[model samples]
Target: MVSLGYPEERFEDVLEERRCNSDLLFSARRFAPPTYKHRCPRSPAALRRAVLDSPRLQQAIREMAGEDGDTEALRQEAQSILREMGHNQGMTVVRTFAFMLSRIFKALFRHVRVNEEGVQRVQKVVQECPIVLLPSHRSYIDFLLMSFLCYSYDLPLPVIAAGMDFQGMRLVGEMLQASGAFYMRRSFSNNPFYWAVFSEYVQAIVRNGDAPLEFFLEGTRSRSNKSLSPKLGLLSIVMEPLLRAQVFDALLVPVSISYERILEENLYARELVGVPKPKESTSGLLKAHRILQNDYGSVFVYFHPPMSLKSFISGRLDITPFSMTPRHMALRLSDTLRVLVHHLAHSVVLRQQHGMVVTPWSLLTTLLLQAPSDHLFPTSCNSEGGVHLPDLLHDVRCLRTVITKIGAMQDWPDAQSHEAVVLSTLAMNSSLVTLTKEGRVLLNVDKVDRPKCRDDILNRACTVLTCAAYRNHILHLFVRPAFVAMAQRHAGSVEDGPTFSHFCFLVQLFSEEFIFEPGSERKDYEEGLSLLQRCSSLLYPLDSQHHPSTITTNFSVFLGQIFQPFCCSYQMVCNYLLTLEHGSMQKESQLLASLQEFALQQLLEGRSTELEILAINVYKNAVASLSRLGALRRERRKDGVWFLTTSQLHHVADAVASLKPPSQLPAKL
Candidate 1:
């Protein structure tokens, strides 16, 4: 049925979103109905304890059918109705039949994108039986995205297992049932009785192949663009029944999604770091709504080929708690889903899935960061292989180039269009101010229909310099000396963890998609000062001597810095300034002073070279920031030779003074 309400642009989007949900039902796997339709939300155990919880609901169901039958009569009458509609599981009450109605209603309020990949592949696997589409969780909106995307792609409408914390939420409750959704207690795993019922019901669906049951494999959204480790609790439902029935032919489809920028990154990061994130206050929520209304983020998704559960079982894949472990399953599934998530994240970054229209902000951001740092300073190049700033037009040149390289991808419009799109996007929303040779062309305005000129070159060069200034700061303080030294220690063990998982989480955090929340971090650290110190030592290189400057070292530094604000006791923050040594000026005197403070009241003996690395990296970070306008790219000569412009070496007393922490470097890394 068409929507029967007033429709406007805002509602148009909302309605489209709803329709997207409806579309899923058309194509989703239909699991078999439970043998008995309880007609109530209460558990059988609970019902065994109570009077008829279903009486009222059953009455409502019968009333909907134009009759007032006794409970037994009702059961028998339900049988007739079931017999009438051969597909009916039980007397499907419109009230209990809410799942059907909701699907139709959803047709009015959703939007989706199921590229050709989603359509063809999903249709084949989902048409005859129930299948789980395990996708990465990165947004609260992920569930909505999955439902809508499936619908748009003409895939089956899945009955999603949603958390029950907000049960009785009139709007939410109605919405869930309407979309063929049911509740699973957020805390029910601990409540064995409820767990059994939920599990059994899910099994019935999968076993009967009435409706496909879907669960997010990760259990939670990933803070970075990477896929998270799967929480196997929910998947246990599908497996338990399969194990019991000795039936395991179902396919597990991995669906992946990526957003231009996750609106919840800051929110989720704070929580992960143990900071509280109460729902925004009403006023704050309203303000956020206004901001969201104006955001122009591109969204992307991919539907991967299905992995058959039966294949695993037949292959002797263990599913028992003892024999088959969640960690083991997670490791394997994570490996499978990680590839899909990477592709999705990459696709969004590159705008390959959806045709990309370069805005002034993106164009300018690319120019600023992608400018060769050497050109900005003119004297910093290494004799070995030099750093290469991606060509401004390379992506525009290669159709197959992935999107995750967006920080440097150049998909400029042809000379003519590039100039126009850049100018237009700038005027619309681009905002970068640079001091340059040809005076200042407002980045947004300069991007206009004007022909590309020497001005583009001048402005980019200067903009590059400014960004470099900040990147250099990051290197000097957190990266260059500190993490680089720490990486040296662990260089041998680096290959132990899954390389892909590391890339997904640690490496991705430094990308533009996330930023550290500079909120009340000091308070947290003060409580766990020792933890920070221990972590600093643990995170730094394995040993003192042989650290090399590699991307991995740079990556470690970035990770340390990202965790710094919340690291509490760690003084490797941008807030601190350098200071005079406690007593003398000998070899590593300043470094020693910093370490002494970090180890203050906690350590029993003298500091080691490892601790010194920690202190020096912080000092270098401050120095780098002080010099490079606050960026973290290390400064090198235009000759491709690297240089150590550490703050300790620089004689800028005033600038060094700015980096001293308000408090001492809490004897931590």
Candidate 2:
């Protein structure tokens, strides 16, 4: 395993730095980058013209219009598409927005820490090739934060790909465009003309190599605070320039951003349980200024070393087909290249996860979720499943040690006492947690003045889901070990062969929930096993025949509880699928809604206590896993229809049930 690098200064407070260096934000000399040798630099208008005149796009337009159709009208339609999809980055607008964002961020956060060395490394690479900045999408502030980092470091500002939702906001939309954002519609699969225009616009950017390109590989923000599966559409477009050898090489930088307190925590929780997100508008942006009154602890941004696209595909891919085909013709990716792209995307997410800075709040929340609940709300709240302050401090200390031992960057200060760190963290997230007069920690749902009916369930859900979101920050630290522990329990023995097989199965089942490097299942399994052995969770005897392997009692319980919520959530999804009538079809939206209602009913009846299971993302992943396993199939239709294969559904249910620890087994199961 690679040892994690520790920052010498730990974190540099952006506000403090700004105060020390008064001219840092406004008076620095920005770095100037050279254009790619493949093509001369073109203005935005010239770039649009080039895309419209490209042979590939022209052919697509002709095919869509047909020989007898109005070709002139189709050409005009393509021109309109180009106008809607292009960016107009003005230096004056960039500087004006930078100043405004500086004040807004200073008011919202106490600190924003960045790795100086990482920025310097990127600066060195920017001079040599086109740079692609791939940052994890967790909140709306992500793109703004990236642009700010560039301006602060004097690095070339990146041209970001944005969703059309932002394009409708009056005034704000145009300002964002002027500061370097280009908009695209959510989905345009049926519109070949729009697709042709969008593809060409992105290719022109890559081929020019004038500015760094930025886009979310996940395609959308993660409401659950975990990594979402990569969206391959934009990723493929960027790689096309490299695949066709139009540019010598391009640098792909995976960036990770960690927030101590998210600005959209409550909004995200509400959306997870079926609430529609409010539309983006100038009015909404103005109203959101109220959040600045509160203090958000800190933000950490880490820019990983750049990866060379040419070196990555050196011998693995055969680009001969791409080179031989005319540039005017559409080239489909071969099976091998597609697999390579999938791996590359997953690798970026893994690097992002590894570079995250885990905090004390994350550790405390994780343990809080694992503690048993004796009725969602107890009268006394001083004992009986409520996490006591003293006990929580001790457990958090242990968890921090274990996480550091496994090589995750942690943010605990060496000089502070454990009690101080834990208490302060709890104070910062007071909306989700509270302390009683007797010093017992409890969920803060009771403070909200909601009617005691269905709203009560939702109120509690919002708090639970919000807490779970914080816990997810450190989940990647324990996922592999937790998987190994659960597999051992299911296999009923510690034999390497059976345990490893079960481990592989669990990895495949939860691939959507967790990010595992592709084609590295065997390596990941060995890493998990070795960690378990080091922690004394698993013991391997010198003489296998005489004495078999054994799992330690204490460590087994610790690891098993880490994944209990996930296992219970998957089981709930499978059980719901089993109740559906065989061959009866339901729309995808209807199914998700039904599952949420079903989960709520279980919670009210005391059949389940895992509120985190109510998350829509989890349900989506469960449905995807079922479909992949042949337990559910989606029919080809306008709205799309899903039907269950009764026999296969039962098999999947049984498989999922076996992974739950014996203590968590439902009575019906």
**Candidate 2's residue-wise lDDT over 316-362, tens digit each?**
88877787777887768678878989988998899889888887778
- The 0-to-1 C-alpha lDDT of every candidate, in the order given, reads 0.37, 0.79
TM-score of each: 0.43, 0.93
Q: Show model 2 residue runs off by greater than 4 Å.
A: 1-11, 20-39, 375-385, 447-452, 536-553, 662-669
lDDT, model 1, position 433: 37
Candidate 1's TM-score = 0.43
Best by TM-score: 2
lDDT of 2 at 179: 83
Clash pairs of candidate 2? Answer: none
